[model samples]
Target: MSDLVDQLVAGALDRVTAWPDGALARSSPPPRSVLPGSFNPLHDGHLNLARVAEEMTGATVAFEISVTNVDKPPLAVGDVRTRLAQFAGRARVELTRAPTFVEKSRLLPGVTFVVGADTAERLVAARYYGDEARMIAALRDMADRGCRFLVAVRADGAGRVRSLADVAIPQGFARLFTPIPESRFRTDASSSAIRAGRRAAP
Candidate 1:
């Protein structure tokens, strides 16, 4: 592992359990914008979005895979390897234990998280934070930590789509999120569809 991954992993181990192995770890500094996802079946859409995000943020774009998911089982070594292999020489990847954006912000400060429309909706949703007050508090903490979000629009399969502008973000925290115009990037490529056997194997 390179120093960058080594440093990230060492810091994360202090609070979370993780398993990572591959060439995705690099000696260079981690990216300010991280695109976190399951990457169940890596595809061109993922690469396209990362490329666009890097161009906009001028930060090294990293593909982050959280070993610990909120509703899914922890990823095993095999699962991590299979996914990392998909990256090849395309991008830098990281392993983390953070399952939610709030935790991810606390774990890595001064980061601009690039997420899809769905993830952004969930972030501001009260159910995820237990209540509106808790959600507001989390957003406040995230902003203080220099964490922000770049939300990409996502298609809802019913021929409808939602972008960052569509979601009602927390008051006073609106400055923390940036929206990617649909004209620049839009895709219906979702991991859920791939898992449902709708997408072909790469």
Candidate 2:
């Protein structure tokens, strides 16, 4: 991690210092919540999500990178640093390496854990955590600690956002924000698209 992002994550970690697990003093208290994403190349859409998340919760955003996902393929360790550079000084955010969504979910008690609609849907997949019940229970535990959820609408092929109203958010998971129609930014860029060495950007 870049020294800058390390500082940022440290700052964000300070917010939950009171948790029994202890806090990193260097971290800042995230004003709103975190909008966790792979942030591969950190595209405009991700930036828009951060802005919208701030508007909704009145807090700074943090970008989370999953380490477990990185080992699966072409993404290098330096990718986080590269993506972090894209947002430097533009926002009071930092990059973190979270091995699992559940582990990251515990980082900031009471903060909103932002995710894409597809990810929100996958939270209940049977393969997650080897059982669906444990996943649900874990989310509930996070909620009990003040952690909430925010989901962005998934963009359809036409670049239109699908409705998130019917998405099944587990009980106690409060919706802190939704993607504004105006905040939509379309891109064909994704990790899969980028791995092909094409014009992929996420």
Candidate 3:
């Protein structure tokens, strides 16, 4: 790894710094809304989602990528560079070690998280947090931090379109989410499909 990448990785591990090309100066204001993703290979779907989110919230959307993940291995130095490159001249990005939204909320308080229906579903799943009670607690913490989610509609594996309404959000925490109507945006483009060579890059 180059000296800059090494420094960035260390910063993410130590202080949860936001790296937009270079370190985000301490004077920079925290982002208002962020679309956290693996990006794998950013496509038009991701771009359109950010654009619609910006219009809906009237906030400039920033992209976030966690160097470490719960389900996947930590990104190598080269992998991190490749993902960050996709955003060059396109959008602002923050590199982090926060693998979950709850952690991300702590790092970026009072931010709206832009996510798809599939991610919203996983966010509420009890399996991820060990039990329903713990899951509720996590949501409560995120809410307390003034974190909210702007969810977009996405197609399921069975080809059915799912919206925020389709997610089984905990009763009291339902207010944390707002749906982006299908009328406003929809896309079949997915990074996984593209990576698998099943679809062309958008």
Candidate 4:
């Protein structure tokens, strides 16, 4: 367990501060639907997926923020609160110290994570963990914890798009993921892309 996770999970009261429909929520058991991201600025692309994910799985939907970003500085509590406010009656949100999917599975056991094909692809890749054995071990751990994944299509460069089927998941872990067809949930809108466009605009 990491320092932040220890502080947040110590009291048996919370997995971290949570907000459901703009109101503070009690620390919960395994989450139903979890869309994990930085969510620097929540956008419609996220909302579209969340709505669809909830409908498809018939599970509660919530956005999850990892204060311990992979590269950036940890986010302030106020910043996290401000972002959660944006959901405002639209959805629930969670704040956590877990950065990678492996960590998230431990924190949000039995969760059905919503991810794009790009992210799902990375899950089986070795570079992310620097070795294939470690990656497989981590994924197996998630499965053992009863966590699963929902993957959607995403636009690649040159306007090309890839679907869940496009990702070559490992054989043993294939059952742990569900694919949403492109027709069902495809989106080119991304926060990073949006920021880049704004930066380039005159």
Q: What is the TM-score of each candidate against the true structure?
A: 0.84, 0.67, 0.89, 0.87
State the number of backbone clashes in model 2: 12
Residue 9 local lDDT, model 1: 40
For residues 57-169, write the lDDT of model 3, one tens digit per residue. Answer: 99999998888889888778789879877876667786777889999898788999999999999999999999999999999999999999999999977889999989998
Q: Which should have the higher lDDT, number 1 or number 3?
A: 3
- How much is 54 displaced in model 4, in angstroms? 1.4
Which order, best to worst by lDDT? 3, 4, 1, 2
Cα lDDT tens digits, model 1, 19-105, are 223433233344588888989888878888988898899986777787778998777666766877787766767677788888888
Q: How many residue pairs clash in each candidate?
A: 0, 12, 0, 0
Ranking by TM-score: 3, 4, 1, 2
Which 10-residue window in model 1 sums to the lowest lDDT? 14-23
**Top candidate by lDDT:** 3
**Candidate 3: where are CA atoms >4 Å away?**
1-4, 8-27, 198-202
For TM-score, candidate 2 versus 4, the one ahead is: 4
In TM-score terms, which candidate is top? 3
Cα RMSD to the true fold for all candidates: 4.4, 6.7, 2.9, 3.9
Q: How far is 82's C-alpha from truth in model 3 (Å)? A: 1.0
Please give the RMSD of candidate 3 to the true structure: 2.9
TM-score of 3: 0.89
